[model samples]
Target: MIRRLAAFARPFSAWLAASAALRVLHLALGIAILTVAARALAAGADAVATAGTIVVLAAAKGTAHYGEQYLGHRVAFTVLARLRTDFFDALARQAPGVLHRHRSGDLAARATADVNRVEVFYAHTIAPALAAVVVALGSAGYLAAAAHPALAVISLAGAAVSGLAVPLLGRRPVRQAARRRQETRGLIAAHVADTVGGLRDLALLGAAGRWERRLGALEERAAGDTRALAARLAIRRAANTAVLAATVSAVAVAGACLWRDGQLDRQSWWAAIAVTLAMAPALTAVEAFAGESGTTVAAARRIFEIIDVPRPRVPPPPAPAPPGPSGSAPPRPAPPARAATTGPATTTGPTIIGPTIIGPTVIGPTVTGAASPAAAERRAAAVSARGVGFAYPGSPPVLAGVDLDLPPGSTTAVLGATGSGKSSLGYLLAAVLTPTHGTITLDGADLRDLPEDLIRRRVALADQRPFVFSDTIAGNLRLADPGADEDLLWHVLETVDLAEAVRALPGRLRTRLAEHGADLSGGELQRLSLAQALLRRPALLICDEVTGQLDAATEARLLDRLRRDSAGRTTVWITHRPATLRAVDQVVVLDAGRVTTPAGPRLSRAGAARPGLSPAGSPGPASLGDTPGPRGPAG
Candidate 1:
């Protein structure tokens, strides 16, 4: 971690060097001022010359101090900016899967507080350590040159003890305290963020008081950790101060004895005393920074933990076929032609491939020896999961051998009880989660082989509880399609039955939303999410209980609009709502990590009787067994 931090500092090497140089100059000036003042007082030197020299040295010290501070902080903040950018980029790569192992609040603290703490490594730790070395060595050399080799030895030894030995006295305890302090801080930050986000829900459940007590307990624990750390630091500071005083007093007394023995003149005696005092500042700086070193190390380790997460591998594109003999281009063989598909979509089970033409599209780079564009467009995005399985780390499998097929242009509804893997299946189909045991193919091509950006563009998933940024309605819409204009935004809003409400807002599309759409009602928030997904016009749209918060009338109207608008698009509606099931072409039921046969009656596009089902029957396969009543699906 230290080596990695050093690399980040490389970009600001020039500024750091300048700051170190200025710091050395500042210390040198202080030494010169003290020596000159001592010489003037002992010999009763010319008053005007003495005062002018003292004034000049003081001014130079002040100037160097200013330059050092300016350059040091400039380097610190610049390095911080780069560190934050890299941290966020690494976090983004691990998101939604690898990051699920960490709490959102803990991750947030890492991004903000942890990154801020790293500034000290560059600003206080590295620069000061360098300057201390220079000041210490220069002071020792000055003492030797002044005809006091004995004093020089004493000064160097004192410098070593102060810089090196003093900091090591309580190393283990100080380090432990620092780690505990930072950990407690992160916990407090995470808890506060979670409480704020769910304050309303807690209030409704009459559990707000309990949560408040929990937060207070966390805060008290953090404060206790901080106080413990402070007490340890105070002890260290007192020990360092005593060491500095003893070293300086011993050197001063040794210089006086040498002067009395006729080994040194008056000027030399005063100069030696002044030089001894000069070493105090350099030693003190090192001792003080040692305490902070523990905190810096702990913070850096936390940051690297996130950055070191392994990124998903993307396969290299296949190399073009070797040139034919004689340097002449060989005629390429025509790709296999697929039969045109029509009628209502159907599935045999979770693993069976439906009779739909799966082909690639132009959203991603076309692979060599692939089907032609015209043929690909004629085919729908046929998704199939063959023995697909997934489970969170250290947990039993949530989805096992989940074989299923989604025909092109088919509207399929996934129905299951809570914890039956409905949303997990949706994530798998949308390419958000990779199958652990089997293969998921997009148009006969392994989804993993496709570029992530291409999959995101072609497959849109509207989460049950969508996240809305604190931006205008138009701004949120632009997140799906950046170049979409006002007309396009209004069109998607109208499709989700949210146009009229938005139009009545003070600024219409431009009216800014509070954090996470706090200003909008629950139904409005869901509709807004749908509108954003609709704007993308994705090839596959996965709605994971998108209408769970809407009223029956609004839900029916939105479903009708979705069925009409997504005419040729493959729609995976992950819902248990019977009203939503009426609009889909077919329904697949899941039970305990397996795909069960649908027990609901199959309905036509008009929700009327199908050829194989009884009239007024629920729509689906018989394997689902004992479908719920016609009122609506439960949570």
Candidate 2:
């Protein structure tokens, strides 16, 4: 709570101090005016001078009040704007997995509405509260010594009750209300995002009305909480108000008694009244501040929650080293072992006793020749998985005791039906997620040893459907090669057969892509992703059924170029299509997280017409481990 409030004053600490000074000046003048009029009455000074003193005090108080309010608002808005930006940046930097716990509406509340509500604290409550305490204490002390001591004590009692005691009493319930309100806002934002994202599906299925009803119910609950919070605040206000009136009345009674005792003359009587009146406002200021503290504390807690979430654990060893481009010597192939997942590829269910029979890899004889075919294949240990196994936070193992290899300058077809862990495998290779067991090596170096960004530059994956940000055709193309010259960008487009489409745009490369590439056709987006992948000049390109929906002719054309461009460049093809399987060099089959028994050309389907393998697509169920996830196609 303190940090967030202080943040509001950061941009205008000078202004805050100035506003505070003005508030003090206003209060001082107000009290001074009261003293002057009282003295004028006692001394019987000229009427003009007395009236002028009162006028000056009124004018000064008016100006100071306006200045404090104006400056306070300025600071509040400036800080709030900065806070929103910082909130977005923080959310963006969070690990993808961590976002699962929060609701969109709750985040929005803290970022937008809740933070905005705290404006009063920055602009008015804080400065006024400070000035109020100072004024109240000063007046009480002055009147007690100079006018009426008992009256001063009475004012002091009221200030304590209003400032400290009453507000503290309401803190807990108010805080909970603020917390609930914040959560509701974030939940609402998330619901909106989800509903909009699925609008088309919902409309077709006639479920939009049902969702609307659910959203209405959620809104109603929020309203109920708001009413409860407001009602509590109202009660506190009424109680504090009564306390304030009684304290002021008590001070007045004390002044009358003092006058009767001849301890306070007429001048002293008026001065005591004025001081007590000045102190009265302080109690109200204190009350207001107390009421706000609860909600602010809850809001602060929500913000800290995001900042304090534990980061994803980093595995030991290192990410694999990025390999040289297609033209360079392939690094020495080590056995399947990534330094990151250091533990033995663990299998939870019934460990294989002896002779683990890890997958076989053709580790060609070592040679010194640089140009020979054997030398060219030296870099071919593109990716090797040794005893690869993984289980989520509390779920059963999705993959267990698995070993696999994809060599350099070769096309390896990865076939799996839905839920076959195909996408999880892709994510692991991409270094988007770290494995829970075993090791993954690229070009023979442990992947855990190398920087993930650098590793991905050498290995790119294209999902079946990928997001295309709204931008000009050229702008989108430049994502992979930020510094690519115009000619190079056009060349990549031509390679992916998107050159003609791009040129046909009304604004050509300058055409706006619209929100999320709504202006582009599905095929155009796929081609653009391919162009981006090509521009990276990756050694191992992974295409995860990217052409799943393309027609035969279009698929053939894209596939033809893929094979030609991928020559001597390692490639992994994940497809269910017969044509894609025939285009690759070899096929590795997976079933139930392990190469099935009878694991040669066919698996999964029994007595089913076999799809062609390398020569002809093989027809057996491809290994299905995890769902195909939507992810970045970064090499």
Query: In TM-score terms, which candidate is top?
Result: 1
lDDT of 1 by residue, 471-530 (tens): 999999899999998988887887899999999999999999999998998879888888
Model 1 scores what on Cα lDDT? 0.72
lDDT of 2 by residue, 564-634 (tens): 44434677777655555434445544444443322233322111233322222322343221224322221
| Candidate 2 similarity to native, TM-score | 0.72
In terms of lDDT, which candidate is strongest? 1
RMSD to truth, every model: 9.1, 9.4
Candidate 2 ranges with C-alpha deviation above 4 Å? 1-23, 26-86, 102-110, 114-129, 280-282, 314-415, 428-465, 469-489, 530-544, 559-635
- Model 1 TM: 0.80
